[model samples]
Every structure is written in C-alpha cells, then in structure tokens.
Target: MADPMIALATGLSAVLLFLLMIGLTVYLLWKRRQDMRRDNQLISTNSVIPPCTPVLQTLQASSYGSAEVPFFLPPSFKSSTHSAMPEGREEEEQWKQHPHLHIQRGSLTIGSWFPLGSLRPDLYQLPEEPSEWAQPSGSTVRLCFAVQYQQEQEQLVVSLLQAANLPAQCQSSATLVKLQLLPSEDRHHRQAKAQSKGCQPQFNDTFVFQVSNNSVDQCTLRMSLYSVDRLKKHHLVGHVLLPLRQDELQEAAGKVLWRDLETDSDLPLSKHGNIQVSLNYNQSLQRLTVVVLRARGLQCPSNAGVSVQVSLQIHTQVVKTKCTPETRGSTPTFNEKLTFRLLPVQLDAACICLEVQQVGHEELAEVPSTRATAPVSLGLVVIGPFMYARGRELEHWNEMISKSQELVKQWHGLGAANNIYNNNQT
Candidate 1:
C-alpha cells in the first residue's frame, strides 16, 4: 500500500508540471500574436491608395462643390479598389507590375466633366456646308499685323520694291517675288484730299497676311493697312514670294487664247491684232505640245494654201526658273491682253521666243518644235476641201460670214469685203 501511494503522487506531480509548461507557451504565443497585429495596423495606416471607379461614381453622385472632387487625382488613377499594404510594399508591387504606367494629371484649371468618349459633331461636315463661316473676323487684313520700325527713334513707314521685273502677264497679275530689300525711306503716303482713310490710330504694320480656306481650296492674301508706324529705320523685312502653279499657267494659256476667238465671222481678219507667243523649252522638252481646238461651224477649204497668220514664238531662257518659286510672296500686278489666233481643225505647236531686254535679241533664231499629228481620214480630209475647213461645219461658218458681210466690207474698204468681217460686238 505504501509503495503504490508514493508512485501515484509522483505521477500527479509530473502531470501538473507538464500542464504549467503548456500554459506558459500558450500565453507567450498569444502576446506575440497581439504584437504582430499592432505592427500590421501601423503599416496599413501609413499606406495610401488611388481611387478608381468609385471616384467617378462620387463625381457623378451630385453636382457638388469643386472641393468635393479631388483635383489632383493622378491621370492613371484607373483602379477600382483600394489596398493598404504599407507604402513600401505597395511601391514594390507596382514596380513589379506596371513599370511603364506613367502617373500623370491635368492642370489645376477646373474644366467641365466630359465623358471619356465624347466627340464634337461639327468635326464631320460637308465642305459646301461649312461647320462655320465668317468673312474674316475683321474686314481689313492689313490692320491685324503692322510693322513698327525704329529710325532715329522715330517710327517710319517702310516701302519695298521689286529688285527685278517678272513676266509681262505675271507683272500685271499681282505676283510678288521673295527677295531682300534695301529699304526706300523716300516713299511716303500721299496725303489724301478727302478723309477716305478714316480716323484710325496708326498701327505697327501696314499689311497682314492670313490663310483662308474655301470649299474647294485655300488661299493667302496680303492686305494694305490704313496706317502704320515704324520703330526702326528701314529694316530688311520679310520677303514676298508669289504662288504660281503650273496648272494655273497652263489654264491661263488656254483662256488667254480662247478670248480672242470672239471675232465676227464676217469681219476682215486684218482688223484683229497679231497674236505673239514665246515658248521656252526646258531641259526635258517633250517631243510635242498639243493645242486642242473645238471646231463647230466653218466653211471647209479644199485648197491647202489657205493662210491663217498664226505666229508662234519660242525662246530659250538664259536663266532657268523653277515651276514654283521657293518662297511664297505676292507681287504688284496690272492687266494686259494676250492675242493669239487659230484655224479650225489645225493642230500646230510652234517654237518661238523673243529676246527681252537689250538689243542682243535672239528672236530670229528658232529651233523647230516637234508635234504629234492625228491622221485625218482621207474621206473627211478630201470632202469639199474648199467648201470648209477640215473637221468643221460648213453652213454655220457661211452664215456667220454672210451675216457680217456688210460690216466686214465696210471695214475692209473693199466694198465687197463687208461680206466677211462684220458682227455685233455684244
């Protein structure tokens, strides 16, 4: 009995010791867990997160005050959820993910809330029906830009002159050349007898150029100003280079000749002035130049000897010029008439040129210009060759001639010549 009791006590003591050790370990673990939780809370509190969809929702929630919307939201604040992992952890995660996602923002200026995909309707509109049209916000273009020159501390209006002359047509057609100018101070505004210029304050510049667009194309114009003051003595101002297009030149060539076709059929050919055209063959001269004439009515001539004094003058330029000048400047211009003649159904390209300037002229020397001719059918070419010009109307030409015969003869002084060159100018 004594031995059993001793053993039981030992066992009970051992069991109690084990329970104490277990309890201490549990308490320590609980305290450690609490500390860890506190550390996590501290880290989360210091971290920041960008707003996402919720921000937009808040923005649209109501028409709140400007302060309600965080004005400094990063442009990349596209996330929809918030995360708090300490700033360091957050930065590490972001760096590991979107290294290229640049964080940008708009200015402090408060603008209207525009949806992401909103677009302007006027962006798409028919050219003829312009989205908007206004005859220059101002009537005068010259008033907008003025030159203020400094000369003896006094403002002087400067004048520019053409260093060299241009083609006759170009001269009259208001073309400008872009070149340096040695200022001419002698030029002063001629005093107006009447108050036509109006009582406007002097501006710094005399002319202003603006680019305008129309349905078909765009154009730039330089306008004169009423008054201007120069802050500096004649300064080397900007140059003016005119815009001359090859297509425009070709079109003008056609129209200039077309205008001369209005002569009365009954009128004597002698009454018309001779047409003079000087052609220049560039290095890449084409084998032929084509002149297409429409023949409606005319008396066909069977005889080939009929002479229609059409003169073609061509020239080889000493200095080559580009199709379009490098600079865009406008030149002064006037109007002049270009006279040329053509016989019905006759396709002729002449090589002719006149030496301009001094007496060392080169008009008499001309190389023949080549032409590609279309073979007319023998049947048509031979039919009543004398009755009318080839590929032209016989009855109409005769009528025109018959109708003007009286005036034609009156002008011709050959009593019977009136049968040819007489018609109403209108």
Candidate 2:
C-alpha cells in the first residue's frame, strides 16, 4: 500500500506544474497581443492613400530641332603679331547697331576625322543680298542654312535652304541680311602674298572679317568632322548644334507634331506600393513604360500575414490614320486603338513601365522608361507559429479594425460618401 503522505506530495507537485503552464500561456498571449498591436499601428500609419489622377506636366515646350553642337579647335597654336592687333573690339561691337569686323589669323591642321567627334555644326544661314538696283529699307531678310555631312568624306556641306518646318514664332523681324562664307583658299593666298612664300602644309590658320553697312544680328556656324581613315578605331562624333551667339538661337525651336503614349508598358508591380512618372512618348522606341517593384513578407493573408494592394491609372493617345494606297484609287482608313493597362499591386508603391508599339511590331521596344512608376506598397509575412499560438490575438486585431471600418462606412453612408466629405453637419 502507498503511504498517504507520499500520495499527497505527488498530487501537490502535479498541481503546481499545471499552474505554471497556465501562467506561461497567459504571458505568451500578452506578448503576442502587444506585437500585433504594434504591427497594426505601423500598417495604419503607413496606409496607402490611392493616388489622385496625375495632372501630367508633359506639356513639353514646343521643340523644333536638337540643340547640341560640336566645335573643334587645333591642338597647338603660335601667336603672330598683326599690323594693328585690335583686342576687345569684337566683344564690344558684337551687339552694336551693326556688326564690328576684325581680322585674326590662324591655321587648323586636319588629321583623320572621327565620324562623330569634337567638331560639330554650330549653325547655318542663307542671307539675301540687297540688289544694287533695289534700295529696299527693311523687308524681312530671312536666312536659312541647311547643314549635311559626308560620313566617309569627312566634309561638311552647307547650302542655302528653307526651314520648311521652322516655327513661325522663331522667325526674325523683317530686315536685310548678308549671306557669306569665308573663302579658305583666299585666306591661304593672302597669307602667301604677305609672307612671300609657297604653301607648306599649314596645320593651323587665322581668319579675318570686315563689315560695312550691316550688323551680324546672329552668327552661327556648324562644322561636322569625322575620321579621315576608314579602318582606324576612332570616335564617331555625334551631330551637335552649337550656338556661337551670346543670345538664344532662334533656329533651336521646334514643335512636337504628333505624340503617342503607351499606358501598358509599365513595369511589374509590387504590392502596397506607389509609383510616379511623366506621361509622354518614349523617343528611342517611340514607346513608354512605367515600372514599380516592392518587397512583401511571408505573412498569411487571413491570419498573421500582411498583404499589400497596388493601383494604377492609365492614359494614352488616340491616333486616327488615313493611309492613301499608292496602288489603289482611294484612301483607306485604318482605325486602331492604342491599348494600355495599369496593373494593381499590393503592399507598396507601384512602378508602371509604359511601352508604345504598332500592333505587329510589338516585340521591338519603342522607348525607354520616362520615369519610375507610382502608388507603391510594401508587404510583410509572419511565421505560422506566431499566428497559430496567437490566433486569438489576430482575431482581436481584425475585430477592432473591422469595427473601425464599419463605423466609417456607416458615417459615410449617411452622407452619400462624397469624396471630399467636407460637410460638417450630419
């Protein structure tokens, strides 16, 4: 038979162990509740406020032509004393009633041209000369200089042309203008006559200019230089339009005749995220793309995990084209809808990449990303152990959030839920 005292001791020990377990359970419940509250606070504080429809500032100022230019000078120089070396005169008379003329001398040595290197096209102009017979005061004397280049020859061919596409606003006031080019050969001969010497391959040369009746309102020059050797590895000079004049060059203005935006070219979305970008056409591929990415955790959606939602609004250009068939007797109309999509993401801001393409050539990229995407969100995932042990705590949190939401809904419902909710009275 067992001793009564021993039995009593065993019973007491078992009861104590049971009580300890209960205390641990209560403590754990308290901690989980606290953690959940903190998480809720964070989520509430960082809640996503759906972005308002973007007021696109893509009213690109009317553009006409690329305004970049490349100008090159020789690597070395030797200063020669002029009979009357006038300095600072060119600077003073550059903006006077008429252009002040000065003559300076230098030589440029030509090496193999880089296809698109330092030397660039500053500008071109064709001025109308006042006929000796016609004594007209100031009729708009427009000058248009067309610039082209020989890729292989490394020569710049400038010609008198019309800016058929030039904007009217950029046109100058009616006045007389002079069109001229400094003859390189004449300079060479003059130097020869003065020096009393034959031509040695002069690598550098100086130039002189003299003006009588008219002023140089705006002076621009574009020089296109490329590699002289076809096989040598060299830099290809990208075309540039350098403005030599101190003031704004009127020729730099242009217009965007047609623009297309592809709303669907946005990048993949990450949840609870937002993105913002310019609404415009992509130049390279003639397409647009917006992109957004976000990080989400492993929390369960229903119980202990955080899930983020993403939202997007899309805008695109509607183009109607009437292609006149050269072979047919009529103009055929092609009706096309440039379709785009704004994908929804959860948790963080979204980055929407946009792309614009013709229906058949969808594979080719039309443009690079204009900017990063919008309406971002971030997600978090919690382990199941936390959820399983603290299921009641999660329930409690949901209950509280649900109650708050319900109150808001009821309040809004009474007022018909106008967006602003500015009305103070019930």
- Distance (Å) between predicted and true CA of 273, model 1? 24
Tens-place lDDT per residue, model 1, 1-426, is 999999999999999999999999999999999999988986776435444311222232234554545333433423434254655555555545544332232222112322345554666775775422122232222121212223233322222211222222222222221221112123332221112222222222232222222210112112221122143223121222112222333333312110101222333332211111111112222221111111111122322111111123222222221111111112111111123332323212222111111111122223122211211111111111223232222232232234331111011100111111111212
- TM-scores, all models, native as reference: 0.17, 0.13
Report the lDDT tens digits of candidate 2 across residue range 255-329.
Answer: 111111112122233232222221222333433221111121111122222212222222322222111111110
- Stretches of model 2 off by over 4 angstroms after superposition: 52-426
lDDT of 2 at 253: 25
Off by over 4 Å in 1: 1-104, 107-311, 314-336, 341-426
The TM-score of predicted model 2 comes to: 0.13
For model 1, the local distance difference test gives 0.26
Overall lDDT per candidate, in order of appearance:
0.26, 0.26
